[model samples]
Target: MRTCPHPFASLVLLITLSAAAQPPTSPLGPVSPTTGLVLRDDAVRALIQESSGDRIHDGVQRLALIARDTQSGYTEAAAWTKTAAEAAGLQDVRLEPMKDGPQWRATRGELWVAGAHRYRVTSYADLPMSLAAGSGAFEGADVELVDVGTGTQEAEYAGKDLKGKVALTRGPPVAALRNAVVKRGAVGVVSSYSTPPWNLSHRMDGDFPDQVGWGLVPRSLSTPGVPAPFLFMISDRQGRELLAQLRAGPVKVDVSIATQTDTGHLSIVSGVIPGTRAGEELVLTAHLDHYKPGADDNASGSATLLELVRTYTTLIRRGVLPPPVRTLRVLWLPEFEGTREWFSLHGEEPVRRVAQFNFDMLGASLTRAHSRFQVSYTPDWNGSFVNAVSESTLAFMNRFNSVVYPPRKDFRIGSVTGSQDPMDAHMERYGRGSDHQLFNDHGIPGVAFSTWPDDGYHTSGDRPENVDPTQLHRAAFAGLASITVAAWAEGAGALELARLVALHGVRRVAEDEFRARRDLTSVPVAELPETYRLTRAAVRIAYQREREALRSCLSLGAPAAPVQAMAKALESAEAQALGRLEVDGKARGASLREASPSAAERQARTFVPRRVKGQELASFDELARKAAPEQQPRVAAVQAAITAAETALRERGEGELRFYQLPDALASYADGKRSVADIRDAAYAEYGHVFPVDALVELFGLLEQGGVMTRIR
Candidate 1:
């Protein structure tokens, strides 16, 4: 018997059996006939019916009134959230302080052309986004405006003298500021960046003539040698006018910026609704920081979470819903940085957390924003039954709302004025953009509920009016229902979850096999064996994920009998799947031995590889300095590739590219127990063919050269 970490695990089987014998008569609802699980229809109805769209809209409007990144704004919002939670009868409501570096505030900003064309460009008093975040204080000074296309590459400034001038670029303000101000000695920077619409399915206008976003100049670039400069963001329309003026004649601008940075703490608001079990928790989180009028980006998410908290607490207080078996904790904080600080302060508190449900941009109007409500799963490597649970809940809500409130000509809900149409919710693959990444990085299963393709994202135009209350309600309903089921699940619920994992695993394995077969045409004949190995390994990984999902039920204190039965069933299922594959391989004149590597082929497995934390290859020169004298040429080639990857990532506004083009299966084999030859064989076993041996060598070599990993001798 496996020792359970949870103290309540011992009582789970007893409570589950007792509950099953005597069904509660009150608000606990009925027991599922098929799976013997408890179904709280009353709780589900309260979550759906009690959720107020109007209340959510009001919350968004109130929060959108101030830029929440500022100290005063953050404190006010935190206080308001705490008061709201307390008013809803939630327990342990508090304002937790996070140790963020500093608070940045923009007070004043102005830019005006003085030579040949006397006209004002933009002002912070008129638009906060025009000032850009992290800009330092500067007085009015007339400087020539130099148009450097993109302003990121050194070639952009080949013959241009940027000293004492303001460089204008089409890239983002942060990138342009780094290149022109810190690197080229420019006094300031101006950026005109826009995200173009790729779809006309919803038929919304794509032109954003006045949209501007936040920017940052790292403190590292603000040293005495390289002074950080005041950066300004303008719309594409304003950029075109300035560029045209520059082309006609010499144009100089008078610029003045007043911004301040001081030591400050980030405010994180948290509240809990206690459950029957102790220590077990499910966290619901949303970011509370953004520019003023950041409605769809995050205010919508915060409002939705608040509404859920209100609805849940109200139902529990009224005795219409029973308390869950696991605690429900809600958190409102700054984005990634704030989450990191919270984790640092809490230490191992996260170990008690079973799952995280993150809300971000969940209230966009589908027709206006060209958005789709998505429940994005955690990546395959972190697969769990939570994915199926969330997906099923969203699908159920989508169907329920369509029948109850069909889309009218005005797109209003039934008898509700100004409300939008029903939600067009769908499942999406894994994506990394919000605070959920922080939770997932700490081994917590985190999922995101968001709306994508919002035109007002990170822009001055994102206001409360653009948010759809009906969409917010639907998202809240889905999130509430999914998490409630997980929090209150018992023996029967665990069995149901196990079944879903098995089905999902089978489907995933079939999809992997299909993809591998399709990729065979692209593989070289010599590498076919490696490809076959990789494909098999993928199937094995799918089975293992299913097993892990089933085992996780043990954490919920499920009965040993049912849990063991499910494990045995899974073993048989995996055997049947593998047996079919083996039979197919035999008919094709191939054998299992051809796919699996011999013992002699395996390298020594005693050496362990450890990854170096917080180390990055910042530049080609840094890579050369780290590499040995004889390895400079190879390091230089890899450095060039990394540089190009970084450039591409910047242009696309995406994350870093540490393992670009490397298969997850291959990467997973890099654990200390596996040697380089073992990893190669594993890759072939899973992917249906091996990658070039030289390619694997180069990858490990680059990792060593870049200070990311070191081999234990």
Candidate 2:
């Protein structure tokens, strides 16, 4: 969790992993050092204070305070935030003003909208909608209105004339609607949707397209904004029903949306506490807009960021904070729009780089009231930042929950990199959801934090009581810690920083590389070819073939019985080797000597990555000759298996398994007799197995239970 920046969960695979420091004394730490400095920065503290805001805890006091403050357009909350920062002795703190666009906003009681309508209306209830918008061609004008739904399928309007009439469509990809109306020569367009305020819909940046010359009419009908005949949008259930009825009666709506129609106001916030190295930038951020108060919605995140700035400023003032390797830029935005402005203006990738840690919710506990602390992350081939960050976050969580806060594993941290590798796909899931949206959109390795299924995410229920100070403190700390790690790695040596990540953050769930490869295959063959840096000797390189082959055998839930048998054997062999092995002599293998693999086979199957003699296969003809070597009657089952084995080898080749150059696909661990599991253990980590085709498939569904590969999908 990043305080100046960045949520919670529950059965985690608690590996009993150790952290550098002993657990803290309380979950409510005034601070915890993530990278170098303390975690719970002032911004987080202020937010916690703000959550328990300076007013009576009564409903009227809160609403009255909100109502008294006018935050429309330039007269926004951001404007006041500047005054507050300055009052606190902060310098260079300014609100990043947002663009208001070409649309106009009407004042109270003014006739902001007035338009000619073939369908007349007195109130919202009388306005016609379905026939006026949903219908492709109504009342047969010279040109027909092309009714587009969502506009995702452009092929829907192959040969239609949409000249002069309205192009009524559905939802906002505002740019798309603008293009359609301008291209098709419609007078205007009306898009529709019936979603809630926080639905996200994966389509919000509503920036209208250029190269089009048409006015726009958005029939948004969602929870946030209303249709103004303004270029923007609107929604209402009862009114929509009445409008639908009137339209069914053949009424047409040509309502004016803009008399002076436009958004009320919008702006993004960016604050920087200059690091020693300003040329390199580390952007920490969160969004600050919701239909309501949005405490956990985002006020929590933005407020936390402010606290970080405050903490750093205090540290700098006291000269206690170390000069950073990179400049720290904390940004607060109105979701996508803030990021859009930054990218639209300054899209260049930061030359002096660390990583981006965006914290969205990050401060709520007990949606179920029994869930553990959670950490979500993103990974990259460039050593995957997400893996390390989550590891770090969980380390903090465990310390807080287990040691500091007392005996409870209630707080747990994890990164999204586990089941869904956003680094491979769906960075948008995290990136687009918050201020990081633009960062990822710009191709930076970034990760954002927010609570999952937050009960009061966007609704009125999203008040300050929902926030957890303990969680907020952890988030602030985690964000700073990961950023520092990334910066330290960039400024110093990458491997050193990476080692800290490996140690404090991310788990090498399965080491021997071979076993880990299985986790990859369970995902998809297409994914296996994707590169992940590995070390033959402490250096990283992407060798997809060997990785993929290992992945395939491990991926199969359970390969054929022969393969499972082989894997079990390999497991046995490694147990034996590891028993005699001692780096610091930690792993206890002496007690299970009988459980070890065969001595000869175990020695042969050492971690050499090349097949040794004795277990080696000759040419197919030679193998056939040996299979029938002077036997009175070769068993039919044995003969059939031999043929299958040859075919299996051929199939593996198609999948890029160069088995002939290596050893036979591990069939069993050396159970004093060498099996496949033993071979894998010998090859990699503890308690391992690698099933080629048969046994691998069976294991896929089973391994998930043990947090091996939770689910292939």
Candidate 3:
């Protein structure tokens, strides 16, 4: 028997008992100061208690049985989700069909190695990820297996004959196909690209094989010169065995794949909980597509969303929770491609979306999955008060649980799952892997609630058993609380959000100041002026970004009074933060100049950067084609940097390189109204500390040369 550590636990228990004994009421009480909405700790506690991890497990178990795509499996999963939403008592539950490009469906696939030692490699019937999505049908044929280590690089295949043979690699399936099959004429590929916390082999007890999530052989590569090859994913242990056989002597593999491809509709399951305001909406979304047994990758997210719908509907129907002022919309998409199709079909309707919350891989057990929940926000340019609200809600939950449960390592008395520790979560910056990227691309402020470092992510090992019910409840609670606050926030709530933005602004400025000061040491005394100019530009842009965030609150119908109050608060905070910089400057024996526009600003004011008419978004190829002979080398360098960074991002499965790319940032900020200098300043504010000025200049120069941007005087 465990004893409560604090008197607060007894108080909390008394409160819980008292609340449980009382009857449900409309508009649940205890309004939060941060969100200007009723938090209803009692209701939240009840919902959490009622939440079934077993239900989540069951849902994941069902979804994980098939690979959800445009095939029959996808249709089945969509129907099931729609039914689940309907069963949850959600209104207007329906499957929205999206017309998309070619849909690849694996009907059958098999691989067997028959050289040095005979062994079966994989079977699609057993593990869908083994076949690597998009593989075309092929008759069983024996071919020599040649080892191409990390087959993504050309150097890796130098002096090796890959013709009429199978390329074996430790690289990703996609990369191996591109390098070995498309370029070198390999008939097939065997890859073993493991998930992150790469030290899993050292940490975990056995030889664990990882799933190759999905692989694609582009149509463009299937021309007369390059034949699309069948790609098979094998475990690291199996791949090692093949490599050992190859080192000892020649190894041969027999491969066969039978797949179906056709123009099909990607299913999107969606429904709405109507609010008083007709058009305003808060979207709760999660992708429902992945390899078979992709429990953590997306089944968890889908289950969590369903549970949220159930909880919200139950509470609203029972009159224990008030319907939001703005409608709450739920979407289960087939990952990125499906999201893109949905947006294309809806077109401008996204403009009415106030906020979007995406759930992906959210049910990982802290102990079993080796994961932690992360509340990731939009970029600084797209920042809103939502970040503050969500972070604060999560912080409050952590504090509340700490007091109520006390400290215990094994488990909590009332906790439904194994772990006894309080919910551990932290705020994360912008990331670009899931469906949220599409929303953010369309100017809708979106956040992703997910867990990271799961060894079984995108692998066969990600089963229903790895998901913790308590974590599911916690995730559902955090997501619900944030959405509810955003949906119901009135003028006062909007004002609170503004205050948070101001606070965020203060922190951003302080961080920039600290970074700028630290950077000063790395530069020569003669270069201080340039560095100072850049730092000042960053500070001004930071304030402008905050101002933009506060202004966006108006879109949510926040009253003028609150907006004005926010402005005043932001002004005070900015002044105080800048004041400290001056003191620090004096102490460092350097006279810091007041934040002001630089010579670049003056030059930029003379010209506006406008988008070219009827031109597509700039790509590396377009930039190269548009560059002059002399500028081609510099253009190539920029392209190389971006490609290398993206490749590193894919291989590591960690870091913010995906979000920090300068080309995308420049493209996003380069509107006709903003000058070149303004765009540069905004980029500096967002990512200037990490990227050098020369690199930025070159990227902007390429964009200008590529006609993606034209300077009009």
Candidate 4:
């Protein structure tokens, strides 16, 4: 009789064996598998159609129409694409506009320009906090002017509220003072100088969604550490002379600006690249439109995907790319608004999508990028195919153009934190500021791509001239490797079952009894239905946390040390999640009453053991005969994870570092050292959400103290 390898057990063995073979590495979580499970053409094709973006050929024609006189947005872009659609044998072509920013505000005060109305809010007092205050530091005292340089210190602001008069403070050298000014609320501050001021410098947090780092500060970019704000570098000595003039007399001006919300026509563009296979699906996508003129901003990717339509189709026609395993659906969304609408329209469709490959800003120099071949993956994909199912889809980027363009080199990708133990992750999400968000929110595997270290992001200079072809090639090739292959090493049932299990883990598709039972031929245990599948994954993850906490409590052995504090923190967290504090005297409570002892006692206790301590474990069929009908499979799964964790805790070194900090892309984006554009490119590189670089670093610090992981350095 055939028997299946234990799913949870196999996962344990994989982790155990891999760690034994590796050496010390970075703290950036474990690197993951770069390839995806290969599927048959029919299955893959269905998934593709359910995914991918629109296929437009003859870029020159599409561009020609876009460059036409009447083009304001995607509406005209789509209307002109009729001929291209017909040539591609597709009928519908849409040009949809995505509305973003009005909902997004610049957290920092903006520097707007109009012919004669040019004013610069040089200090933090110019932001919203000060916006409501109306007057700039209008204190009622005799104004004594002090050129304290940039007031970036508690000390600079020490002992005085320099109000009612110009408090000549220096621009910040190290710490940013935008927030400090809100508290200081000085009369008026004299900013000695500034570089070519960024109109969007003070951006609303929401506008920059991905966690791209601003970048590592070039040593020569400015003076070493911004000492006192007075010493910080600014534009010119002329501005300094002007500041000296301000101290000569009283300067007062009325400050007034009106802000209102307006209604405008909003749209989202969507197109498709069909596949021969009808059932399974794969999605290829990229945002064709942006808030600013983004040729390299996205023109590089725009041109790239337009070219991919030709490349993939040509491969199919020549039988080189092979028939897709699923139907491919290509989408050129207008970003945020388009995603919201698409989901609203088709949220209920139960299409089996193999994966979603999202390509965003994919043009930049490969050699200069922060995370070479780095791709940010969402934490869910292939419902049952994956164990942790933490990845939306497998996201991989070529190390350099060389990784994809052959002379074919091995794409050496690094975790945002690569200096750790066994490399099991790409740590891309640390840099997840991009377009893959909709899919992740919708519960699909989303992998995004962009060249890390986005030097030309959002500024006027991020033009077509700065675009790089190799970056596009790396992203496209990496995406194809993970989503488009075939051959069922685990068999069709495993493929299907794995997908089912993964989905079941996430609460997407429900598990059907018939299918689970049909595959029972290889089962060493009884078949499970949806109810059992869910209970297991949640409880397993839950107990893993609980067990670690309990062990921390035990290790401290005594009650109030750091170890004990950690144990208590975990215990408190576990109790909140489960609805009851499992403290000594309070095991049973109203919130988490179901899993209590009384609850367990109420349900009949059935013990149909799968494995014995001495002999080979009994099969599910045999256990069923001896077992009572009351035992729940979920209860069994929880007990299983707990038992496993306890075993590991005994042998211990440090726990999995992945649990602590974010991936390398994120780390690069985080402010301690790496650059911002690098982090932004990570999500674009991997096709995922973009997080703020500075905030994530703080989070990494918190995780280190929690004992889930230790910083590698």
Candidate 5:
């Protein structure tokens, strides 16, 4: 490693330059570039240098060889993690059992186009994802291949003879199974569906034509007497070739699959380093389970987690860093189900959880994936100092990892064995669909680091070769640094955190107010009143969350003076922003007077909905099955609304809430204290979308009707 004789001066100057770019009162997040929190300069630099991309890359390569898909592969991966954690000097490393999850493992599978000549498309031996999980056993069954585009709707299957034939569709495999196999007696399905393209710039098939996607047919979708349908996922190019052959002549396809299903427990691997504080903890989490060869989708994250354990433990043992004040725990688990189970265990220990950092899909090569590394800050409703810490770390990584013009000798933060690729990293607003959601839903704030426009996510192209070592090194450095700063927070460090929270709060308020102004300016006069109400709710709700974030500093043993001073400054900033919003509204011919809630909103205020323990809605399919007969139509309607909203948002390529995420957002606020009106308001503030009160009221009513929830009078 090269020596930077005076790097601290360069580090400080970088922060000063970044702050100067913004207003003095609202600097981005933290004072120092590294770790965001106030900590020893020497320790921060050492942590950065200690992160090894080669070590992380080796771990990723090893883990990618395991078919870790929440079953046999997941169990095997858990054992490996347990042993590795112990070797890294972590205490109390164990594999915890999460019970009652569906389990299935592939034995042998292959798909071939058969006739006078045989052409093998794929096999489980070559790509495990080619054989969808939960597929039934079949032996060399030859069936006619029918081309039913999408294969999800009756229209797609119209006038097609699918009986005992294998259906080929570019839609979800599960949906194809339900509509074509279960309902219409198809033998199986060959799907080529990948995640929808992000935009015109990032088309999955155009970029990675040979990528075979991962798919599954859930056991719940099985018919009573009918055999379970097997599904095979082929690449888009292969699928298109099959379609062309079908147009020319009748096509015969041979499919074989052998799988076993058992009711077994999912696994969670947890490793901890004890601290002076007993129950208070900071957790670093990454899902260790995905398909085989899933390097960037999750193996990268899990590998980086292992590296953090090794680096931190080694540093503390070598007397290079101080022992943490709070307990630090690292978790590798199956994505959603395992996360929920982990939180359910320990009798809901959310109050003791100070913060969490989540890593997922962190090793993409910028040039290969055309993706950017994103730090998704905590949701607005559960605001905390963690967001500030994350923002600061992100800024540091962006500046240090990228090539600066007239590169200075004083600034050196590069891995020796890793590529010195300029990083495309920045902060993103709250995003869903990762292990971090469970923590946020439990009222504990967390942040997720990920790469977006992942070209091969859930596809065969997410192989070890697709991962970049430099990206892994940068992510590990930033992630470990963020957690370390929080773990060691005390008097002076806590004070700095307090100031950072206030500084970040002012910037957020400004951003929110600016968005609201744009919305108000565009609204038609007829809809101005309703739009103005939403705008007011958005800005005020944001200010309240900022206050809550400031208050969170007291838990870090921060002195009352800094906390109070920052709170006052936060108040002043919000007040100024609100005044500007008022002027904008008045100029647009909207009244600034406080307006009462509409009848629907007022009625919503009366019902305080609480989720039934252990019965919260987990998926839309589960809700459809569990809802009462009369409520089925309503549940379907609500789900349809969510889908429509999600499509609209995605088509426009903006907003934070995905259709699938709306339920969790609503559930996060349903703590028996917030009225339906309050939940609606919070949702509006968080995503800038006004969910209809009728839709929310109907959804909860159906849940209550199904014994999944109870509404207080």
Candidate 6:
């Protein structure tokens, strides 16, 4: 038998080791060079000291009390947040409403096994997530609940009599409802489906077995003559139990949903910390809508924004920090839809939206959730000085919260009444699935601060208890510091930040060269020529990419002379790196040569796609729903291509580009100047995925047909 050590043994060992550990005794000099950030360290520190985890937690707990959607609940939450912002002394605090048309709201809902045993399956009163969004009303007592396993196919219901009954399925609510409710005449659906574990590491049924999923039924009910019915989400464990009970005999359950589908406007809650400059500002945003108890998925992010407002406002008012040179504005809105609506209405406002720092999920307990705080910077193709600044700020927080043996920094930070868990944070290339997508899609660079692989994401497990107050404090500190640094990027600090952009630009370009060279040198001789072609293309495109990134520094009010110089240096760097590649190819008996464009590539090169004056690519879901009847087939084909591209890229271990990011990446490069071929090459270089030229041609063709873009011969 194995013996257990005392629980205090590790603590005692750590103390003993600390006493005997050899070191320079005193703190060492900086292990790394100082980050060229124009941070107001004193002000940032004051804000950090003033930030309240408890207050943030209170905000989250309060917001999570309402099952917020794009309906009345969202309006209520917005009103509360608006009041809080005003009370915190933030100027220009108000709720701006944007109509999203009619939306669904569930008032009372419950599903229970109504036999002798009286087993309660779920109730919206107890857990709001149990009621899926867009679910219609269905009141019935002891309706026969038939187990139709994955009832998404006709074959699953061939022999089942679901007429006037309820379907218990392990498939998506929409798909199951279409088959069981629409085709087989079922009255409602009980779905216990979770996305496959491989795609989302933590959203597996095995991980959170009792988590009632949050999902949506189709809003339009676009199918002709199909009745809109109710949808109830039960846990995977409850679903399994129901399935097991079905093995013995049939089950009868009572289903009641008092829901309403009504017109409501999506609203945005806005507050600002005043600045010296009138027309320039940095935007911080978080989505405020999710199911009840949606703590980490975004109540945490929204609550943190409130805390930032309080801390920054109080600090500035107390003379702890000077007013910003550029205004700092924060927004709480419905995810995606609200952002798109806001920008559409205010796209040409005189106020320049310089940059964005979007907080999405910031309060996951790192240890419990097996999650790490991630700063997803701007994409490589869309790289900016903001990334370097964010990196520097994250580094500062890491050192500030660490338990270094001999301390690199002279100070450390931890909440006295909160967790002491080490801050696990890292930086990665751009990722989609947040409000920042809107900023990056429209030529503005943005960064999204979040936690990933959250097991409870989009489920009932995303409760307030799962959120850590300490994590909120750290995230708030890092985000506030980063945005402040960017806001104050002028004078000497701006020069340093500009230099940092140049340095990071060089490294980014060099990284592409490094990867290409490694692959070129190792490939067989017959494949060497083709590899060299792609290698050379990567190096050339990297220079252009980094050059574009360097230009973003000018948005910080940095001097144009230095930024232009840095851009010129990128060309020089590319030449040097390409020259080295030539030497390697020469030694390998492969001559450096550009591959002639194939017929398809040449054809693609002839057509230039331009945005339709001022239109961003509509989301695929919206396009599918709104497309004319004749365009339905085309929409389906385009979606298939997107799925195929993402699948192929994933199979090749490519993660930089995700499925949802394809349209945005394409839109980013389609500036009316770059041909389809040029855009494809640049996108390939940025993401390391070789999307076929034909795919680009077809996508652009579809976009043109949709009136979002136009093709010039």
Q: Which candidate number maximizes lDDT?
A: 5
Superposed model 4: Cα runs more than 4 Å off: 1-91, 96-262, 276-280, 291-296, 318-325, 368-371, 380-431, 486-713
What lDDT score belongs to each candidate, Candidate 1 first?
0.68, 0.39, 0.69, 0.37, 0.78, 0.76
lDDT of 2 at 557: 20
Measured by C-alpha RMSD in angstroms, how accurate is candidate 1? Answer: 9.0
Better model by TM-score: candidate 4 vs candidate 6:
6
Please write out the lDDT profile of model 6 over residues 41-120, one tens digit for every residue: 44444656788777788888999998786477788888998998888888999789897587777789989898899977
Name the lDDT of candidate 5: 0.78
Worst 10 residues of 4 by lDDT: 607-616
Task: Tell me the TM-score of model 4.
Answer: 0.41
Q: What value of lDDT does candidate 2 attain over all alpha carbons? A: 0.39
Q: Each prediction's Cα RMSD?
A: 9.0, 20.3, 7.3, 22.3, 6.9, 10.0
The full ranking of all candidates by lDDT, starting with the best, is 5, 6, 3, 1, 2, 4
Model 1, runs deviating above 4 Å: 1-39, 115-117, 196-207, 225-227, 401-423, 503-506, 516-526, 582-713
| Candidate that scores best on TM-score | 5
Q: Model 2, range 1-713, lDDT digits (tens) per residue?
A: 65631112111222223321333111112223542212333322332232221111222112212311123522445665556455544556766666655433222111111223333222212221211211121122322334555555667556756555544454443543555654555544544443233333211222212111112234442123422222323332323433464365532344333133335446666666665544676777776554334556566666666655665555445444344545777666666656667666555554543457777776655432122234434322222444444454445544534433243233222221111111111111111335543453343556776554454443334556666555565555555455644443331233233333334221242233443344333433332322111112111111221122122222212233433343344445444433333211222222211234355334334322222222222222223334433431333333444345445534543211112212112211122332333333332221121223223222221222222222212
Candidate 2: segments with Cα more than 4 A from true spot: 1-71, 87-90, 95-100, 103-259, 262-267, 349-351, 368-375, 382-387, 402-432, 458-461, 484-496, 504-713
| lDDT, candidate 4, 14-88, per-residue tens | 998897556422111112233223333333233333222222112322442232111244445444443444454
Clashes of 1: 22
Name the TM-score of candidate 1: 0.81
Q: What TM-score fits each model?
A: 0.81, 0.45, 0.83, 0.41, 0.90, 0.90
69-179 per-residue lDDT for model 5 (tens digits): 847788888898889889888889988888875578778898988987888988998888888887887776568999889876788988988888899998778788888
1 versus 4: better lDDT goes to:
1
Ranked by TM-score, the better of candidates 2 and 4 is: 2
Model 6 quality (TM-score): 0.90
